[model samples]
Target: MAIVTSKVAGHAPGQPRGGVVQMARDSWVVARRNLRRMTRIPEIVVFGLMQPVMFVLLFSYVMGGAIKVPGGGYREFLMAGIFTQTVAFAVEGASAGIADDMTKGLVDRFRSLPMARSAVLAGRTLADVVQSAFILLVLAMVALLVGWRVHQGILKALSAFLLLLLLGYAFSWIGALIGLSLRSPEAATSAGLIWLFPLTFLSNAFVPVNTMPGWLQAIAYWNPFSATVQACRKLFGNPGVDGAHAWPMQHPVAASTLWSLLILALFSWLSVRKYRNAVG
Candidate 1:
């Protein structure tokens, strides 16, 4: 009998074959796959943009008169919040996609391949980010039709949009974890929204947190959702700027950046860990 020594089937002996470069390549492959699927199912993109467009129209027309924004009209104030809410709600799609993959046994198939484990989740979240950017573009056009303008220069406006995308990407990790834990796509969709309602509603996304009860006000000001909304408002030069005393409201850009980074770090780790144990 001849004894043969070789590296474990997929991995290199001295150094791991697939390190950061492999992860990036594999992640892009997965992202491209998901993006192609979206192109085939156009409804996903259409419906995603539709809901936010409806919100822009309904709120700008119906409640625009009732709401009072400091130094600006309600439509202007509402656009940032609308943008934030729309991006935040994008988690539903992320969760549904991941859940669908798991339910269809695609996760197991991927695990059998010699790819980085993180690629699965990273690709899913990256695909969601691309979808979100498209939605934002459509929403921005609709916002302009409804009389929302970015008074700040183009650079600032771009920054606000980038911040919204970053926030959405961070939130997608939460969806990724939910999808991994849930049994069905339907369940993942429901679970994703259960907490999102309060997170978006309770914050300054719609109304001023100062209007809430004293305790609720505290929570809203400290809420990460609120931080992003406020940052967008400031960067876009929209109205509805209250809570000058609160750290988040005062330094919203920094606050949003910190909150997004923290969420991404925490949930990405958790989701990847869950993914490692999940397929088996």
Candidate 2:
């Protein structure tokens, strides 16, 4: 019993030490594995880029003429919205990816390893972040081509993008929870987009909140999604400012930062807990 217990605890003489460092290392290995998979399947990156590029062109030409924005042309105003939407949509990919692994019995394989259990979710989310960053770079170039200029200096623009990435990271945790709970890639993919559509559309992504009905305006005004969008507009020095008296609109940067951190903490805890139960 003692020998078995020692081996199970992974504290036996020949076993690897377990700690935060080990967890990080295990996570990196898993992240690298996913990254390599992304490389082998180039369609993953190409498809991700296509949607945002289409949105950029579609809005910049088709819808740009119809929408009116304050402080800048529709192109500039649309760029920030495009940026937030792209990163926010990472939730769908995360959910589908995680669900795929679960349904494929990959979770069982990971469980058999003497590695940190949290590393599975951590590594997947990290890989999503890296992929999102690359997509963002390509989307930024597309935005520039459509005459989206950063009125604010480079530092502020960089800061805005960082906040968007942070929000994206937080969003991936929500997806992780969805994937683990659903346990089917197909269902996860559909369920992931179902919630996201309302979250993105009801907010000030494509239209100003004031244009929405009074009650609807309030909801959009206080939305965490809107907080990030507003923050990006302010930081990017673009237009489409919500003149509402809502606290989120008044102090968007702070609201966005707090909302992101809160989402990250809450969903990450829920995801890890769900992961353990799902695979246990």
Candidate 3:
């Protein structure tokens, strides 16, 4: 009985460790694996590159003239909306990647291993941030070409960019959660876009919420996407027309940024908890 008890005690440590060091190690391994996958499939980068460009083009030329922005011209008005939509699309890559891994049974294999369970999510999330940042840079260049200027000076502009990136990172966690919970890549993709399309268009990103119907206006005003857009517009020093954009009716930048941080915290917690449970 004593020997059996001792052997059982010794076996306990053999189970996966769930501490910071182990998590860090696991995350590093996962990040490396993700980077390699990106390398092998350059299409991943291409897809990210193309999405924002298409959105900017589609909105600027196709919808820009049609859409009436209150304070600025169509290109100027289109910039905020385009940025919001672009970041929203980041979830596409995150969800798709996770679902693909799940489909390939790679995630199951990871579960069977005795590594830091959180590493998979951490690595994937970090990669998502990097990819999102790259996409943002591409979009920024395009915005410049299309006459969307950031008037907030270099320092403020950089800060705004960071905030936007953080927002994208938060949404990536949502993608990760959806990816793990869903059964198929196609299902994840569909779910992600369905969520994205409504969230973005309904907000003050492109057209002012005041232009929307009374009910939609209310929804758009409160939408986190609108907050982000309003905040970004403030940061960009864009002109504001009352009864048009609403909400950040004043300092949209600060309000939008605060909401983004809150969201990031919420989604990160949710994703981490879900990931641990899935691995366990």
Candidate 4:
């Protein structure tokens, strides 16, 4: 009776907790479930790949020479921006998927199970990261065919790509929160993209920050998206990386990492709390 009371009161001395391990295992299982679902719906992957590829091709040829970067091939500079945009777009997908699951009672089933409370959100975000990576790979190939070359060494180029994935993972947490807050997938999808247009467009993704007006330039330079784009340009040794003097643009790698990590932490906590309330 004393032992039971002690355990109940959280005074179980010397008893090892398997919460972390169990949570990880549960999260992986959820992630795999999502991945398998994606595979079954082949059009999902195909459409995801096609959108970014289309952007790459259209921007490369139609806008070729239309926008000029002072020091590098506009194509090379455009790839980083397009790549960042594509991964950041994962937030929409995450929102829609979670919203669909909730609407169809999938989340209710998970809630009734023995899995961790965080497993659903964590699993969804993890799956988004994987999907983002696969999309990035295909997009990069399209970029190469369009004359976008990575001048930096392979390792640096890889580091940039990794940062983009990190950004995607971070943003997916926000999507999780959005999906949980909304009632339907359609609403979630619309809410998911509502901010992204400003977040991506207001940043230095497609154009040089210096080209924007003074007030707008400030916002673009300070944007988390801009930080990642500038970081990628520097890592890939592409053009338009040197004009900005802001702290983020000057030290983009650090800024990008900090931004991604900050977003991940804030939204992860919010998402997990939202998940609890959603299922409570």
> Residue 74 of model 3: what lDDT?
76
TM-score of each: 0.93, 0.93, 0.85, 0.92
Model 1: residue 123 alpha-carbon error in angstroms: 0.3
Model 2 worst lDDT window (10 residues): 4-13
User: Which regions of candidate 4 are displaced past 4 Å?
Assistant: 1-18
Off by over 4 Å in 3: 1-18, 240-251
Compared with the true structure, what per-residue lDDT tens digits does model 1 show for residues 1-280? Answer: 3356554466454353778998999999999999999999999899889888988888888977887767888888888889998998878988899999999999999987888999999999999999999999989988888788888889999999999999999999999999999949999999988998888889998877767899998899999999999999988888887755889989999999999999999999999999999943
Which is the winner by TM-score between candidate 1 and candidate 4? 1
Candidate 1, residue 76: Cα displacement in angstroms equals: 0.2
Per-model root-mean-square deviation over C-alphas: 4.3, 4.2, 5.4, 5.8
Clashing pairs for predicted structure model 4, backbone only: none
What is candidate 2's lDDT per residue for 1-280, written digit by digit as tens? Answer: 5754654554444465689998999989988988888999999789989998998898889988998887678888888888988998889888988998999999879877888878898898899899999999999988887788888899999999999999999998899899998978999988888988789888999887777889999889888899999999998888887778899999999999999999999999999888877852
lDDT of each: 0.89, 0.88, 0.76, 0.89
**Where is model 3 poorest over a 10-residue stretch in terms of lDDT?**
239-248
Better of 1 and 3 by TM-score: 1
* Rank order (by TM-score, best first): 1, 2, 4, 3
**Root-mean-square deviation of Cα positions for candidate 4 versus the true structure, in angstroms:** 5.8
Residues 97-189 of candidate 3: C-alpha lDDT, one tens digit per residue:
888888888888887788876678778888877777877888889889988887879887777677677678778778888888784899998
Number of backbone clashes in candidate 4: 0
For candidate 2, list the clashing residue pairs, or say none: none
